[model samples]
Target: MAPTATRSPWPRVGAIVLLLTALLSVIMIAFAWPATRSSVHDIPIAVAGPSAATAQVAQQLSAKRPGTFDVTVVDGTAAAERLILDREVYGAIDVSSGHPQLIIASAASPAVAQALQQVAQALGGTDAGVPVRDLVPLPADDPRGAGLAAGALPLVLGGIAAAGVLTSLVVGVARRLAGALAFAVTGALALVAILQFWLGSVEGSYWLNSGAVALGIAATALTILGLESLLGAAGLGLGAASMMLLGNPLSGLSSAPEMLPSGWGTLGQFLPPGAAGSLLRSTAFFDGHAAAPHVWVLLGWAALGLVLAGLAAARTARRPAAAEPAAEAVPATVAV
Candidate 1:
């Protein structure tokens, strides 16, 4: 050990900066690219008319954009409307009339509705325009979908913030959980007051919307907290990455799941953000018709998070006092 090699701290610091820069770049690219390149992928639309007309319309649409529209043939307009309300299809075309009529659920997605309008117009030709009707229109107050689209980000940020605060301020699993729950309830109420009452963005039963928001916040916060408890710093990083990188863009809030790049949309629905968005939409517009699954998803995440936190606490409590000495010895050896 006559000539010990001394490593400069600058190199380590520079490498960390470079690595972080690269990571940020990757994240930015990953999120931006998919959103910019978004196109209709297997969007479900029904054709309600005679068998011949239905087949003709379906074939024509398929010809225009191969694999873009999943055209289902229904007996008549009533059947199509039923499907739309049931959340089976986004829009439906009634070729039963001389001029085609497009029925859309704007509550589902205005962008998709516009796209369907374009398709219907194209089919009907320039002279005979396709008459478009919105079955489930968006709220008069929030017609542009700005509110619904913007909802997910706040919830995501709120969850992360809640987790960060609770982890730093509170100790013990039970206390952390209680903090998360408290934050969720209060946060939901506050958000509802701002976005729903003041801004008039969110429209629905106040209690239902608030409850949905609370569940979403609780699920997100508890999940992050659980991960932190179980895996320490690494767990927090993982949770953040999952929510930001994978969950955010794939959420399908601005568009329907079918509008996203195939499997990615479906994948997003399994996450808390997507589930939350869907649940909120259902509650707001569909009168909670298709909200059970989304509710279950949120509940499942909350349950799992609680379980994980409990296990982590129990494990920490059970560790022997002698193990602390051994753990300290290992770190000392590593430093040497």
Candidate 2:
């Protein structure tokens, strides 16, 4: 008589899945965190104190950190306002008089906006004079500051695909490369079409749109594939956080780095998604101001990814002699 083997409850298995999901979630979020516990240096801010005051503020910012605040000295208050409207600087200060004015575009990074408000308050010291208030707010529907989101889309999509690929890699599983790549490319193109046609993301030739979208898709997929080959599952989380979160935030999504928080603000141009987005936008709206650099960046990512994938595959290649096991020599008489 054999006793029936006891079976474990399915609830424990569910708990383990849930636990893993939660752990991954935690790790991913941590990787994407952009904030320091207390403060960030080099935020692009507008200082409009008097010529002396403005210059002083600009100098103070530059002195604090390189690539933090660009500190443009506008012609006058109206010019500054226009800059804000055009999504130029985050906000402008008007230290034209005894008091100084603090301005901010709420549509930009809320953190930077809050930081500007704090700066305004600090300037309200007893020594500071009367202050005027002017608001160059973001569009009502632009809370996420998506006006600047176009440029970062490539990075975000790239990361998402990378993460998906990486998750599979973590399990020591590989999906159909062609199928996944095709899907990835299709999704990117669809997004580009939607943004360009529906959202009026660009005002250029259809060829340009197609080219830009295709370039983005190719670069993103290649980068993810390359990263997965190099870093395995971990690269997925890292690339996602790097391209999507940090790259977008640092790329002047809402306002240019000139108005970004000190330090990381100046870093906007060099970041991948940041650079790619700007280049695409320039080609879309403007006439493509020196797009070669950005094109190279995207190409570089794609190329690197491809190479890594090849290397990964090569590493798993069957050895030439290993496949042919040695055969025993048969006697000549046995041939008959």
Candidate 3:
């Protein structure tokens, strides 16, 4: 009887299945828990008024929800508005008048604005007379932020799709790079056209929006491609997990990061999707004031991806050529 094969594929298959199951479990927990358990924690807000009254109000608000706010006392309403515009604070409360005034930049986050309104109302003792003002309101066309929030998932999906297509169909480093660039430009144009021009959700310089979207796509594509080049198929799995499982839900595109559960907001901001979302928001609404750091983050990821691709290409180039079969005719001479 022929010797039995020593190695079995079953164990490897089982291990892969087990690993994937564990990964899925982790992904569900990370995403679901934060979303379900979300609450205010250390959200920055300004309380603007006479120093004594502002301090008292701040103290009261903090007491009501300890660790919910990082309250700063601003001298006046103008100062608070400036902070909001600078993306320094989400909302401001002015207790100078007989009725408390809650000032919010709804463009920054409608959820945050709503929360501030609730807090202000609570502070007013159920008389229900607090005036909530939206200093930087969202576009009237997309008043509920539905359009912008809806854009995030598509952007992520588009990046993943583009990368997957390129890796499957394209060959050679130069060709892949070129394909990525072309896709980035065209995809950005189409997405911006739909979201900004047709839907009117995003309001900004057309060129600026186009550039931001393009950079985001390029960063994502390059990173995925780089991982594939360096680590083969496993790299693709890791990339998908990072971009989809970890990045998307934590992104806080539908709401401000500060509005999410503690620590998750900051963690999300460090990832590409979060950075892209923040950058897009700045370009569309805030006149690109706070977009520099996010831009840098995207660029950094792109650079890292390019570097990995280059290294992989170099390694592939240096691989030894396979040996050809030996000439068959020479074997009979010795027996003769």
Candidate 4:
């Protein structure tokens, strides 16, 4: 023992430093890339007027922004309004009167509304007013959508935190599942109360909003819980990392999915965070219109989590039974 050489700590220290550096780089990219690169891409908008005028306007939009807007040409402003109300489009350019008027749904996305207003101003000439109409206005209290934007990250964090606690402290798979679900339901209700009543961050049916929030929380917590059950502590890290790093940033809660660069936005919609945000908005502002897709995405994730958790639980149960049989056999052999 006295002659044994001591292991160098520098190697371990260097490895940790390198690992931290890599993690930092990844974190920076995940968050910064979305914010910096956020711009309109294939954002659906309607152009209402005669075919010739609408075509010309659409062509100008295409030429000016180039692939930014997906223009839906409608004969009348009424049709364009219908599209916005149905959640089919973000905003509309009503050129039906030969003068361009921008109809935007601020509740759908303040950022998109602002951007459309700017485009309208440019189209109508800066010297004249753009004649903007907010079809779906955000709550007066949270006019800028700051509350909803700020709330997105917390929802992800809350689910992760609940799952972590359950994994560490709760015993039995059934108990863990029960605890996560209880938290999701109760926590969502409480959070929604704050957002809707206190902060005015949301509108529409309170229970519906709570349900949407609960579903999102359940999806995240259950998925992480199942991962931990199967892969031990590493599973927790993987799940949390993916949710916080990938899901939260790409959620597009601050703006709109189409604002994110190309495919990333669509990818985010499949994740818990993005699905949750979209679902919440639909419930809050759009009367649950276009909510079926987000609901399905969440359901799929939650189902996957349940299947994984059940498999892990079955494996765990088998281990104890197998050990018991082996122990009994060993005792009998020794006695004989």
User: How would you order the candidates by TM-score, starting with the best?
Assistant: 4, 1, 3, 2
Query: lDDT (0-100) at residue 199 of candidate 1?
Result: 71
Local accuracy of candidate 2 as per-residue lDDT tens digits, 156-256: 56546654754565443245345345655566566666665666544556566556555655665566656676677676566665666566666664444
TM-score of each: 0.90, 0.54, 0.88, 0.94
lDDT of 3: 0.84
Ten contiguous residues minimizing lDDT sum, candidate 3: 320-329
Stretches of candidate 2 off by over 4 Å are 1-28, 35-40, 44-68, 72-144, 147-155, 158-188, 201-213, 227-275, 284-287, 290-294, 316-318, 325-336
Cα lDDT, model 1, residue 217: 90
Best by lDDT: 4
Angstrom error at residue 258, model 2: 8.6
lDDT of 4 at 119: 86
lDDT of 4 by residue, 1-336 (tens): 478887769989899999999999999999999999998889899999999999989989988999889989999989999999889999999989988899999999999999998888888866886799999999999999999999898899988999999988989888998999999999999999999999999999999999999999999999999898888899899999999999999999999999897899999999999999999999999999999999999999888788889999899889999898778776544654
Ordered from best to worst lDDT, the candidate numbers read 4, 1, 3, 2
Q: Candidate 1's residue-wise lDDT over 233-282, tens digit each?
A: 88877887888788778889988777777788898888888888888888
**Model 1, residue 100: what's the lDDT?**
84
Give the backbone clash total of model 1: 0
Candidate 3 local lDDT, 122-240, one digit each (tens)? 89877765788888898888988899898888877777787788889988866887798788889989998998888888898878988888888888888888898899888876786
User: Which residue runs of candidate 1 sit more than 4 Å off their true CA positions?
Assistant: 1-8, 321-336
